[model samples]
Target: MGKVTTGASMSIDGYIAGPEESGFDLLFQWYGNGDVELPTGHPDMTFKTTKASAEYWRSLIENTGALVVGRHLYDFTKAWGGRHPMDVTTVVLTHNPPADRPLADENFVFVTDGIEAAVAKAKEIAGDKNVGLNGGQIARQALDAGLVDEIGVDLVPVLLGAGTPFFPSLGVKPVQLEGPISLIEGKAVTHLTYRVKK
Candidate 1:
């Protein structure tokens, strides 16, 4: 069986996005500041990262077969211009799906149920690969339900004084994790992974 995981690019002070959706320039500098070229499904989207980060990204792409994202994130990027850059099937946990894409297509799946249902749908699509949960809310819900298997954090140097935090409040506080099972240093980012200790 595949694992369920979530990850984010966070600042030193633990913000995934800055206030008013700002600070992206500082948060994502590593994405374009490196020599290694990593291409995405979007023609215009490509990542230039250090060799280590490139390897990490490649591994993520290989292991992640599907994703579960919240509606807020879906709307934020305008559904990533009709498709997610990862080129994988995405399940959106939304109260109401968008009008244009009313049905499930190659690009997206809409789940009106709760987070568990959304994760289940993504798992069904993922098969032997991992199901990546996107956004802080989704992760917190899954963590509260004890569904997540691992957590990955790409730690950057800068701190956003106020903004969306990477790890949101979990009802289950003091959750235990085992091992920084994997760690790598990239250009201005340190990638860390921890297994959720149930």
Candidate 2:
């Protein structure tokens, strides 16, 4: 019994990343860069300050046990050179398996086919900690299959006019909010936890 968390920095318009994103440069631009803080005036909500954003990100990352991501993300991690905090047990979801992956360590394992297989493998490996659904597509798969129990979404303060949509196409389902926690430092970072009504 573990929670499935989906964490992403979305625009005010609800886009997760910019268009044609083979890799997560958009993710790096928003989460990686700490220089320019996301502006606070969002039509949907405001991120009170930058410190709040950092605190929120840290909190989410700290809770994640294992990661389930697409092959694209795995390749992106490889291109960015070796070793990342996400270098723990990762199950890459893809149709075609890679001939050779840079991460050959015992921690990294590739899962071809679908999210259920990936999730089952991750849970088997991750004993006690929670599982993190790495991307929008993967999240959709988990949500559709009723694998995810909870989600942690970080509402950043910028709107990328066009980018990856946070919530992709999926069948209707009920999700009830547990409670909202706010980390107020520079800005206000809110973690809205949701329980998927199964």
Candidate 3:
């Protein structure tokens, strides 16, 4: 079975997202229409020499086969009211379904009730590849249940103290670092990776 991975960025204050996350929205603000998109070769974008960051991530996402994300993140993605990421099937964990929802695009699927069910649905869709843990709560649930295979984080600079964290307090389990590298984009941004030790 392919490995399930969780990825996110955090701050020096141990916050995955900054206070209010108002600034967090600006995390990727550097890359937009007029700005110079950081070179794909830049270390921050791609973690390894053999793989371009975008390609690498696209591969992982393609391999994902399925995805499990919390409702909040799911809603946030749908806010734009257009195409969502992960062309593969997605199972959202939530208690109540929203009144008006995005139409299913063959790949989009919704699951309510609990975390285990969400993972099961994701795995069902995953087939041979592994499932990807989408957000903080979902990531934590997968980790707590020992379902996640790996965690690839892209450490960014802007710190958000009040917003949701990448990994909420998870009973102090030890996470050993695997392959890590620092990639620099133009001047202020950096991308880092860490493979969770099981």
Candidate 4:
């Protein structure tokens, strides 16, 4: 089995998305922004070193075998046009599955049970590859449940005064994190990786 990882890009103030109902365009502007090249031979490298930050992001998506996302996120992105950007199997957590019963294909699966079931299914589908937990709420649940092995955050310089936080409180005990396995400083955002201390 492989590790369960979660990642997101948040503002300097730690907001993942803008105020309630506000879109995430500004928070995710780095996606469409120009490329960011990093220096060679960084000591704290985790994954394969890349010349450009965009390439690093692409590599992450490519490496992930399966993904778990919340219902809100799934609906917000319009199911990524019925196909995920990474083109990998994705499991969506929701209390209400579609009326069509199993509305999934080789690309997506909707889990109505809970986050644990979703993660289990994702791990099964992922096999030896990594299972990516996307978005804030779902990531929080995974962390609270001790299902995530690593956390990576792309810290953007901008600060959305009022917005959704990247790591919301789960009302559970604090979770400790270890060494930033990697730190890629980019023109738009800085990527930092931390292993969840088990």
Candidate 5:
């Protein structure tokens, strides 16, 4: 059994994306700032990051077997040009599966039922590896549903004044979280992880 994690890169102001999705260049600077080359499923999207970030990114990719993302992100990336950057299976949690998609494949799976089902299917696919949840909407719903075991963040230095938050408003406050379990400092970014208190 693997853990379910909410992993994202957020600004100092705690936003995953800036207002109108304007500050991506600032938030994703670390992905291109270092000498280490990290390849992705996309032939054109390799990451150049510092040794620390490179190590962290590698570990992330190694442990993450699948992802649960919302429909918004699925459509936003145009289905990541047919596969996600991590090169792992991605489970999309949506209201409706895309009309043209096969709904199940080596690269993608569409779960239209709900977040719980999405997580379960992701976990099944993940096997012994971790399941990563993407986007604020998906993360929030999983957090509220107690499906998230860990929270991972690559904290960037910039502050996106206003934008989509990493975690949207929940039904309750101060949901207890245990130790930051791990923290690694990378160039222009700080990788942090906290375990959710059961």
Candidate 6:
């Protein structure tokens, strides 16, 4: 089996999205200057980044074998137009598994059962590689279930006063993390990686 991990770009206040679930447009401002283009086909899409930063993002995408995401995120990105940015096997956790699966690419799978089932399916698909949790809520679910192996945060410097928090109350015992594997200080963000204590 492979390790389950998660990574998110958050604000100083720990919000991944702004008020009214406004999207991470501001939080991910680092990628807006032609360094990275999300959703693949934006009108102003471009890819230009420093070697280190490119490698950082690439490592996450290349290393991940499968991804688990929440339904809200799935819909937010329009299911990434049926093709996720990472191009890996994606399991979407939702009660409503679209009426027609064929609308999406073969790489996407909707798991209606629950978060555990989604993670299980992702792990099954991932094999020896890592299964990445791609949304805050799903990440919390995996962490609460003791299935997460690592939690990575690209801590941005901004402060969104009121927004969707990245780590909501799990209502469980405190979870410990150790060793920030790397702390890459960028002009707009600081990447922090920690291994989840078992």
Query: Each prediction's TM-score against the native?
Result: 0.97, 0.74, 0.72, 0.87, 0.97, 0.89
Comparing 2 and 3 by TM-score, which wins?
Answer: 2
The global C-alpha lDDT for each of the candidates, from Candidate 1 onward, is 0.90, 0.62, 0.61, 0.79, 0.91, 0.78
Q: Which should have the higher lDDT, number 2 or number 5?
A: 5
Q: Tens digit of lDDT per residue, candidate 6, span 41-92?
A: 3333445544455667777766788899988998887877656767787888
* Candidate 4 residue-wise lDDT at 149: 95
Q: Write the per-residue lDDT of candidate 3 for residues 106-155, one digit (tens) a residue.
A: 45566775887788877777888988886478888788877776775555
Question: Whole-model lDDT, candidate 5?
Answer: 0.91
Candidate 5 residues 1-198, lDDT tens each?
999999888998999999997888988899999999999988878999999999999999999989999989989889999889999999988888888989899989999889999999999999999999985889899988989999998899997889999889986567888878999999999999999988
Best by lDDT: 5
Candidate 4 accuracy as lDDT: 0.79
Between 1 and 4, whose lDDT is larger? 1
Q: What ranking of all candidate models by lDDT puts the best one first?
A: 5, 1, 4, 6, 2, 3
- Compared with the true structure, what per-residue lDDT tens digits does model 1 show for residues 49-160? 9899999999999999999999999998888887788889999999988888865988999999899999999999999999998758999999999999999988999979
Stretches > 4 Å off in candidate 5? none
Error of 1 at 11 (Å): 0.8
Model 5 clash number: 0
Full-model lDDT, candidate 1 = 0.90
Off by over 4 Å in 6: 34-46, 103-105
- Kindly give the stretch of ten consecutive residues in candidate 4 with the minimal lDDT sum: 38-47
Q: List the residue pairs that clash in candidate 2.
A: 48-187, 48-188, 49-186, 49-187, 49-188, 50-187, 52-187
Q: What is the lDDT of candidate 2?
A: 0.62
Q: Clashing pairs in model 5? A: none
Q: Candidate 1: give the clashing pairs.
A: none
